[model samples]
Target: MTAVLPATLAAVDLDRTLIYSAAAAGDTAGLEVVEFLDGAPLSHATPASWELLAELAGRALLVPVTTRTVAQYERVRLPVVPRYALCGNGGVLLADGVRDPGWDDWAAGVAGRAAPLPELLGLLGAVAGQPWVRTVRAAEDLFCYLVAHARDAIPAGWLADTAAAASAAGATLSVQGRKVYLVPAGLSKAAGLLRLRRLLAGEGPAPRLLCAGDSLLDAPMLLAADAAVRPAHGELHEQGWTGARVAVTAATGAAAGEEIVRWLIARA
Candidate 1:
């Protein structure tokens, strides 16, 4: 008789990790469109990645953990539909494309422990007055983010000041690519993933957790996982963020997405 291995749970970030936008998709010739807006191509993944993702999904429970809003995440069409998704930086949970009311109630309780959105928005308003600030928008009514004309043009001191303010208000500030995020301290991707893991475990044995991401927002999730992987590009890599169990892919761009999928299948 052969020993049976326990099931595995894989949580993955979408943007710049498993998928890439046109600007980030190097050598787009063979890339397949994964997202579209108004019939215009928005994001893509390599064909090889799609095939590997399907295989990985079959081998383990795959959950998309992203900072994107529910509406934004819905735009993405993956080869395999995840049974659960963590969106809005863990502010919202979706089960089979529908919002989970229990998760909503839990998020409300968590939100009570953090500074109000209005206060954060006020701070963002002040920062938006700067010439380098392009636009500021709220996400899922849970957090706020700012787009800069040029990330380099934004003063380092200003970012530091914003971070301090957010910290004082029980929130965290993160800059990824050209966007600045003001996330409430109580909400995190790890929390959402853990909750989902518990729910899944109730159905069977607890699965080993594997995560992959490419940004600072994903740090908590990666840290919480049994094993994690990251691409060579994105905010986390630029910051030199690493951990004992975290492995980095050799390639960048869409190729990195494929590499991550292949790694997940092998690990599973």
Candidate 2:
């Protein structure tokens, strides 16, 4: 059983939201490395964001909701270890650093509504053998994505056609940086947030939800919140997405991460 929480429930994405890579970061000065891969710095956060995030962790239930798989999510080392995290686009949830079995079951039950994983993988054949595609693989058998070089070089109608096809297959497609993702319609960050809300409500009063993200997948989770914020760059911003209560950050890259953390701390 968990105790009541007086602070807000903050659900934030990882890459390009709270952290940024060298290419995505624009500038690294005054930023701290939060993740490293093969001994190389991979993701970074502004020093101000780091200090503010630590403070936010103390004042709120700061949950890192991300599209990364559990293993990949583990690679990140934030200043504050959040009590809860949703990885695999919410197909996997962790509580107090341990995977939550109940949440896994819930996600599995919902997955049945979507096409079989094999069918989803078949969709990959479209991009397979393409010169621009760099890597393609499944994540925890929950979703599939492909990283491409020169994303803008792909045929204009290709993504739209593929997205439409994915929708018919009971999934949604999103483009984030060099990655093209196809996620099951039934498995969503919003659904996971709902489960979190239910679990927290069982412990005490319902907490206000505040979310932040910079990509298309993050849009659902952001929209599900009582209030949300997004960086000026990324898919949603490019799409000109807007909501009655949602806010957009003034900066982009690593600097925007600091602005977003400050936004959460002030509201939380």
Candidate 3:
């Protein structure tokens, strides 16, 4: 068995952090399929990332903290199976591939204080039939999102107004490329990471928290980490976000994923 790092917890994001879709993955050469949809490859990893991740998983408690739902996350076949994972922006947690009921309860409590899910969903109902939007759906019933085909085609001022409305409703809005996420204000990846920390508290000394991501939603988790990293591109990079403890990768796209895994391994 790969020797494990008992005092290092690496909470990493998947998409654009360690995995990438064809459109987001800059160079396809030396890429390996990590996710599939309908029997076709949908997401991929750099050859170097795939190799480094195996080592990182061995050196730390690598928990994937992603906005993907549990069902969607299961589609990714990583080099190692993480014992703990946070999905749906911390709306769901999984242990050994099974959904954790207590985590669900915690998520419910967080969501309860926000606008009702249906109300949040209703806020985006108008986009369902808009030509710019490709899909409009609720995620794990804790959040909603809209996939857009053309960013410029989105009606002007609608996003800002919607974001403001979401804020007023105790919800938050984030735009990541084609997807726009509307999540409960307090339901964050950082919160899930904290819960994991609490669950692991008495097992041993507190592990050092390391994180990586490339999105605004990931900001909280990254900030909460002892040290974090973000790629040179993506939502956060586009906005020029940086933190005292967060490092920015020199590479972008698939190569950046490789760099991130390497960072975790080096730090761990």
Candidate 1 collision pairs: none
lDDT tens digits, residue span 1-268, model 2: 3475655889999998998988889998777999999999999998888989899888888889899999999999888788789998889989888998887888877876888877877787667788987878899778898888866856668888888888999999999888888899989888888788777778577788999998888878887899999999888999999888889999999999999999998888
TM-scores for every candidate against the unseen true structure: 0.93, 0.96, 0.95
Task: Give candidate 3 misplaced runs (Cα > 4 Å).
Answer: 1-5
Give the higher-lDDT candidate: 1 or 2: 1
Looking at model 3, the pairs that clash are none
TM-score of 1: 0.93
1-268 per-residue lDDT for model 1 (tens digits): 0122248889999999999987777878899999999999999999999989999989987889999999999999999888778999887989888998888888877766778998988778897878899999988888899989877887898889999999999998988777899988888898888877777677566789999999888998999999999999988999899999999999999999999999999999
Candidate 3 lDDT, tens digit per residue, 13-98?
Answer: 99989999988999777799999999999899987788788898888888999999888999999888888889999889888888
What are the per-model C-alpha RMSD values against the true structure?
3.2, 1.4, 2.3
Residue 147, model 1: Cα distance from true site in angstroms: 1.6
Against the unseen true structure, what C-alpha lDDT does each candidate score?
0.88, 0.86, 0.88
Please state the error at residue 123 of candidate 2 in Å.
1.2
Error of 1 at 84 (Å): 0.8
What lDDT score goes with residue 118 in model 1? 89
